[model samples]
Target: MKYRKFGKLDWQASALGFGAMRLQIIDGNHGNVDEIAVIKMMRYAIDHGVNYIDSAHGYHRGNSEIVIGKALQDGYRSKVKVATKLPCHVVNSTADFDRCLEEQMERLQTKQIDFYLLHHLNRLVWPKMVKLGIFKWADKAIADGRIAHFGFSFHDHYDLFKEIVDSYDNWTVAQIQYNFMDEEFQAGTRGLQYAYEKDLAVVIMEPLRGGRLTVPPENVAKIWEEAKIQRTPQEWGLRWVWNHPEVSVVLSGMSKMEQVVENVAFAAHSQPHNLTAEDLALIARVRDTYRAMGPIDCTGCRYCMPCPNGVEIPRIFGWYNEAVIHNSPQRLRSYYSDPNMLDKSERVENCIKCEICVEKCPQNLPIPELLDKAHAFLTAKG
Candidate 1:
């Protein structure tokens, strides 16, 4: 387990963080965690050197934190920095902040949170959080020693991400979705650098893009095979994230014992900017080849912005492309159903066949038809 500097905090966090979102489970259901297996996996990872464990109020329907609470017993609690998040979507009042935190602490069997975050930030919830006095409550929590650090996990575009980071100077750390293939997507490479420039510890989520990158497409696998320097798909994915000195810890939702073993070894040998030029070119080629498999070729130019009914055409297409390209049914379904974006009156179901966006689209995509396909595929399993 390799440790790295975690922003301005006077601590060195392990380079690899254990994300409890996908812990071992008895059933396929979100909450049916296999407690015994989860305990062993977490303790074994910590015993090796993973000093950071990240969980969320909604991960595994709250079983994630509970299992971690159980694993941290017997003197394991002091060996790691426990990170979790506030469920921002349910915040209807200022008091909900304290209520949720208390619930989370109780679930975790802890008195204080080492690293606490605003669960998922986006355009819709950011202003709502501000109006609800999140900062005032967070200030009280920090001053009272109930929580040690403040931060957020983001799912919005780079512009909104910059705004949120600049809005709070007290943020000690943040988490973002970064991978070898998602350099231009939400909170991608640009957002990572912006947070780093602000002196914030940037933790990486979905370093494998929800496990999609771990098994590259046939073309991508062939490219990897010919890279001359032999490596597995998982190693390539992780090393790319660690290659950047800006990244503090790369989080992986390890469900099996073997994953923990392999990822730990990779992190131990990871170094920033260590990939050779040939290696970088190979990675770029692989990313491009995989992206070409998408059905919609939307360039994300935002020309079709402000969907007449607020459908968010570009974002919808992006998610659709992601679902098709990665075959991540569960991951994309969860993202499509985000309360911040979906479940509103403005989702794909509300496209209404209005060709207003068709006229504005620079890519000449059939906006209404594409939305229909996206809706059918994403909502099919759910």
Candidate 2:
């Protein structure tokens, strides 16, 4: 496996980090993890030199970490470095942070977390972290040897990302959702470069846009075929991010053994700036095809934010767009039903036709009308 420097740390991380979000499952059921299959996939990845395994407290409703703990048994624990996130959204105080971290450590069956992150940071949670002195807690954890390094995974605008990165000099890394289709959304290339300039390792999530780029539409597939160089959809997607020197690792949540093998092979051979001009042009075409079919034009600029009714406009639009773009209505419905979706205490039905977001929208999108559509669709499905 190819190794890259993880920020300023002496240790080198594998280019291909195994994202445990999509570990082998039984009949596509998120709750029913195929333990034996997952173990096999993990062992295969380890044998092939994948040393970084990432999981989270909220993934698959906390079952992901348990399955990973089971897979790391029988001397497999020492073969890799485990990275997991603390659910910062659940933190009401410093005590809650302690409780969550302890539970995560127990769930993973590991004494020390090689890389610990504050999970899913946004505008709403950042202020609370500052108010509760979260950095102080992280500093203490690092000094106590409970967490080897401190960082966060982000899901907000570029401005907020920079603020968070600059908030602490000790932040070793930052994880963000990035892919060819989302180069301008949620920190994109700008945030990655900013973090890199500050010497923070940038780990990438959703390298395939939550599997959208991997399963391209017919038009997208045709564009890939015309690229002249032979590559699978997965290889193309991963190679796009690997082409960037700023990206430290591309995490793929592989659910099948074949996927694991293919990703490892691609990572082993990928190099920065390896793609030619023609290759890039082809990718641009594919992106255009997907964008044409996407539901919402929301750039996630967050201009229409701070809703008076406390609605998470960008996130709601995100879920709605995913449903339309991927044609996975059921998946979108599941996201709406998630307990965490109600955290702000505002649902699609709570819009009340305030029209506050529409005026602020840079895209001039019909915010109220869209919310009405989303509410009807999700409620009907529920």
Candidate 3:
């Protein structure tokens, strides 16, 4: 296992950190985790040099921490730095913060969380957390020996990400969703570099875009086939993120023993700037091919943002395109309709055709027309 500098910390972190979000489950139930299988896979990763185990309060419906706690037993707890998140979305008051942290620690069977992140900090959640005195609570936790370090995971625009980083001076890490396809999405390359420049370790999540990049379409598969040095889509996605020297660790939520073994092998060869010009070109070509497969040419640049009508233009286009390109309209439509994922006000039906986004769009796309089509497709009943 290759170890890299973890921000300003003297300790080195493994290149591949095990994310406990997608533990193997039984009968397709997200909450019914296969404990024995999960324990084996986790211990295998730890034995193979994955010293960072990342979990959250709600991952696998709260069973993730429980299973990880079990896996870390038998003297295995000393071998790793356990990281978990305080679910900011669930915290309604200052007391909720302490309540949640205590519950999470109990679940993990750990006294001190090595790295405790504010989970899913966005434009809305960050301010609320501040108002709830999260920083003060974190300081108290650190001083009391419950938290070793502080950080946050983000899911918002780059501006908000910078604000969060600048708000705190003792931030040890900043986790973000980064992959080959999401360079312009939430907390993309710019956020990654900004946090690194500020001396905060950048931990990458969704390096494979939630496993979407692993199963390539026919067009993308052909592009990969043309490469002289062939690699799996998973490896390609992971290596692309690891290629950046600013990244401190890349997290993969492995659900199978095979995945753990394969990822460990890939991490062994993970090095900064390891890919050649040709390799990068090939990956870019693959990305372009995938984009071309979609109907909308939205690059997720967020140029046409903050629509006057409160419509999320680029986000709607992204979901519509992914539904069509990946041939998962049912699943994507479910996501589009989920109130938790997107409010009704942000849907395409909210677009008043004000022509404001039209002017801001760089692709010169017929914004209203595309929204109509997307709405019809995304809301269509199968």
lDDT score for candidate 3 against the true structure? 0.90
lDDT (10s digit) by residue, model 3, range 188-225: 99999999999999999989978888898777888899
- lDDT for predicted candidate 2 compared with the true structure: 0.85
TM-score of 1: 0.93
Tens-digit lDDT track of model 1 for 127-216: 899998888889999999889999999987888999999997799988999998788888888999999989999999999987888877
Rank by lDDT, highest first: 3, 1, 2
Task: Write down the worst ten-residue block by lDDT for model 1.
Answer: 337-346
Span of ten consecutive residues with least summed lDDT in model 3: 335-344
Query: Model 2 shows how many backbone clashes?
Result: 0
Clashing pairs in 1: none
- Model 3 lDDT at residue 44: 90
Candidate 1 scores a C-alpha RMSD against the true structure in Å of 2.1
Cα displacement (angstroms), candidate 1, residue 126, comes to 1.8
- Candidate 2 error regions (>4 Å): 27-29, 302-315, 334-367
